[model samples]
Target: MPPCTTPNTTELVMIMDVESILHMKEGLGETSYSQNSSLQKKSTEAMKHFIIDSALAAYAFKTPEIFTIADLGCSSGINSLYLAEEIIKAIHERSRQLERLAPEFLVFLNDLPTNDFNAMFLSFPEFNMKFKAGIELQGGSAPSVYLAGIPGSFYSRLFPGNSLDFIYSCYSLHWLSQVPLGLLDSDCKPINKGNMYISNTSPPAVSLAYFKQFQKDFSLFLKSRSVELHFEGRIVILMLGRRTEDHSDKCTTVLWELLDQSLEIMVSQEIIDEEKVDAYNVPFYAPSAKEIKDEVHREGSFVIDCIQAYELSTSTGDPKEDARIISMAIRAIQESMISHHFGEAIIDTLFQIYSGLLSEFMVKEEIKSSHLLVILRKSC
Candidate 1:
């Protein structure tokens, strides 16, 4: 092979397969997402009303013989399996209402190839046993529950035609399939300096590029699911989103802005390259409700059933504790990618600065993260 040359921003964004970095840092240990995902748990709880209702609509109205459910971006531990159980609860309740045996279930847990499937697989025995016991306690035979891990990106089709009844994804679709192309300026230099993602400082071009990429990726996502979903099938998506159409909105990218602040401090101390900071763009987007609705309409497959926005806050009156919790959560999600670029050496120092920045941010004002819950149906 030719001498390995470090790829520039343009080449890096193009050639980097998301599966290489899309996974949660693995396992059930402290550094793992399993231990530090309380924020995501809160998101699921807030969206529970929407999830159960949509899942029930699929079961009661469409009532497939072999009910299929998919939990896209099913990362490690309790949350991943938790969704399966909630889905089962929806199926069981509908079955009870109809006065019939619960339909057999084929549940697919989907994530990137590098995701910690073993953590989920290891939890299977308890997941199924407890679920079955719960059914018996209700004086009904256990519904046949089958589990499979579908390892791939959701931007593409992962199942056959009309194969799904209810599809669910939580806190995941914000990730783009790849970095948006053309982050360079008219001068062919990186425009988004010091920030890993969209911030108040980002140029108009950067915001437009990210939003357009989301429109493209999200449209493809809908189109792929459109083919896989049965008539009237329902999909419930709950993820971090922006309340405003403006991509540069502060609340939408709050955590990232803090992260940017951390890196900027490091650059000021000459710890990491200012140029490297400028070159790196995180592959994530927080779409507005209007953006999502427009994409669903443009895809012409899924009709919006409902859209709800909730506030996620880490403010606890005490700044240090808030920073610790938020930093741990951020470390779990982005450590792998950050390590890849900045090396493992800076991990500790980075999050120390990250925590300090977050603490300062909380002291200034309360931070309420915006999360959007969208329910859609396959157009008949």
Candidate 2:
């Protein structure tokens, strides 16, 4: 028999086609479920703003058949469905003023291969019923909405050129598909066996490493969006970022450092590997305004419709509750780490470290004010 051939990254990327990526987001085994009342409330409220803003922005497009929307990185949660409803209402109201036909919508629910689409599909029936009921109660035609799960990095694919009218991604992106190899060595060996970045404290070199990677990835994302978006399309990118008094360090990055220190204690106790600890990176990056501005300018595609930043407090008093939120918050980050390293054992240990740190951090101080919202529009 011919010598066995191991698959490389290129081959793996092919296998990870859109469908495979969707399955991954559906996650392994049964879909894990949770109800984050706080997150749900905040997310719903923020989404309303996006809906209204997007509707207003749609005026620039000025056509009923062209009205469309997509939720990039729409993981297995009720949020996407919620956004769909809000968008429909907002657009319908906007349409009335323009003397336009009731606009039909094409909504794309997207995420990675390792998400929980099954759970989201399971919830669709209820979503439809609720949406239809709401339309009837309002004495309006139920807007035609088509939902599809588009898998793969939102930075990539997302949609074909000029195919989308509006795009939204909440609490996602900022996840570099892979850690920067430069952070490791000339040999290109992975440093932390696949981590968010060596520790959350984000020492100078490591923090810079993450920023560079994000800038590169985000630049590509902007280029992709430029090509994929129609003239005057709108995109709402809402996620977590940090606020800081000192301008030297990126605010969101500083919060990551605090989280790192919390886990360093575990590293000292041998609960986690000190080397692996420093080698990882988070799926999310708390990007600075400067960084975001520079990237957008470099891409030269999107017009800065708006880039408002807000400081939101995310904290839970109880230890168990804190652990759950921390785990969920860092799920994508950790998964990115694991996929790069190629091991399940490390995943188990990372969770152990995360649990310990989350608990300690809860009593020690606070991990709030690292959340933000960013909205952009494709330049005419």
Candidate 3:
């Protein structure tokens, strides 16, 4: 864990234990990530080609007896299973086409300790039966798929050196290990007051602080993966990103801005303290393509095989319905953090205000989040 400190104070403050608190809303309820994660599923579906291509290329490189692949930040949901199934099916098809025995797969699903692994695992029996039956119907033998769970942050080492053959993460890497340090001033006051993330109103230092944190976290991630990945192993990452170099792009920051407004409403109604809102900051960053390239170059571990950007329009053309969907999606991701900081009692009210605000905003403007897909090969 890294220490965060104020410039004027000699005392060092440790970042909060994010792994203990950060997780998607559990179970299959309406508010759970399993129900509200269609946005993530959409991103995964859109990037299926890159994922399959990378997987096949990796298999072709080394036909190992046991193909070990891990999905970092594999949140508990159908989408997680969907990704795993896609990779397994693709590899199975490739082996059949080549008329070679399919390698047994060692699939590791990883996430924070707080993730609901039980719920995810409960669905596995059905998933396995369906997958195997589909393969048999195609007149091919199903490759043995061994599933295991790894609970930890990807910023640290989770696997033995030279163990992983392929890695995939979707809509997860944008989250920093913790909130950036230096967001508070020398006086120990929040510098990014009233904003959960970088916005136009935020000072330049706020953006720099976020970028610095990202660089440190991302570099650590690359270094850890570089050690774990076998030679020429590949990693495919799909994450929230920005189209421009600017960190405060409206496309990336609008969601946060609306949430900030929702918080402001609660503060005005005396439901929560203004100071608490000021001190709270989201532990996430949407990096640009250039920032990723620079970090990979600085880390000197992986060669970028492909990097592409695409936009996902979050609007469904109905302001009210879109607001509801978007609000639930954001709430599914942020409820745990917000509840931890502000209390669980305010969860319903906060997102209600958020949904109303989003409704109005959508009526005036469309919302789109930029996503970056990058495939990297371990080098040196």
Give the winner by lDDT.
3
Clashes of each: 0, 24, 0
Segments in model 2 whose C-alpha atoms lie over 4 Å from true places: 1-44, 97-99, 185-203, 244-275, 316-324, 331-353
Give candidate 1's whole-model lDDT.
Answer: 0.85
Q: What TM-score does candidate 1 reach?
A: 0.95
Name the TM-score of candidate 2. 0.78
lDDT of 2 by residue, 1-380 (tens): 43223333532342334233322223333212233333644764855775567756765466757577777767665465777677777777767767677777777777776677677778877887888788779777776777777766766766888888788777666555654434443343344432343443334555666667778789878888788878888877776554542323443543355446645655676756666555444434567666777788888877776665676555655766776665654543344444443345455555566666667766766655555556777875
The Cα RMSD of model 3 versus the native structure comes to 2.8
Estimate, for each residue in 1-380, the C-alpha lDDT of model 3 and write its tens digit.
33435432211221466778889999999999999998899889989989989988888998888899999999987788897788889888888889888899999999999999999889889999999999999888888989999999999999999999999999889999888888876667788989989999999999998999999999999999999999999999999999999888988999999999999999999999998888788889999999999999999999999998889998777999999999999999999989888889999999999999999989998999899999999988
* Worst 10-residue lDDT window, candidate 2: 22-31
Per-residue lDDT tens digits for candidate 1, residues 1-380, read: 44333446543753375567767878878878999999899879877878988888888876766889999999987788887788787788778888887888999999999999988899999989998898889887888889999999999999999899999999999999987776775566677878788887888878887888898899889999999998989999998898787787778887898898889899999999888778777789999888888898877887899987777777778988888888999999998878877778999999999988888878888888898999999886
Q: Model 3, residue 134: what's the lDDT?
A: 96
- Better-scoring candidate (lDDT), 1 or 2: 1
Cα lDDT listed for each candidate: 0.85, 0.61, 0.90
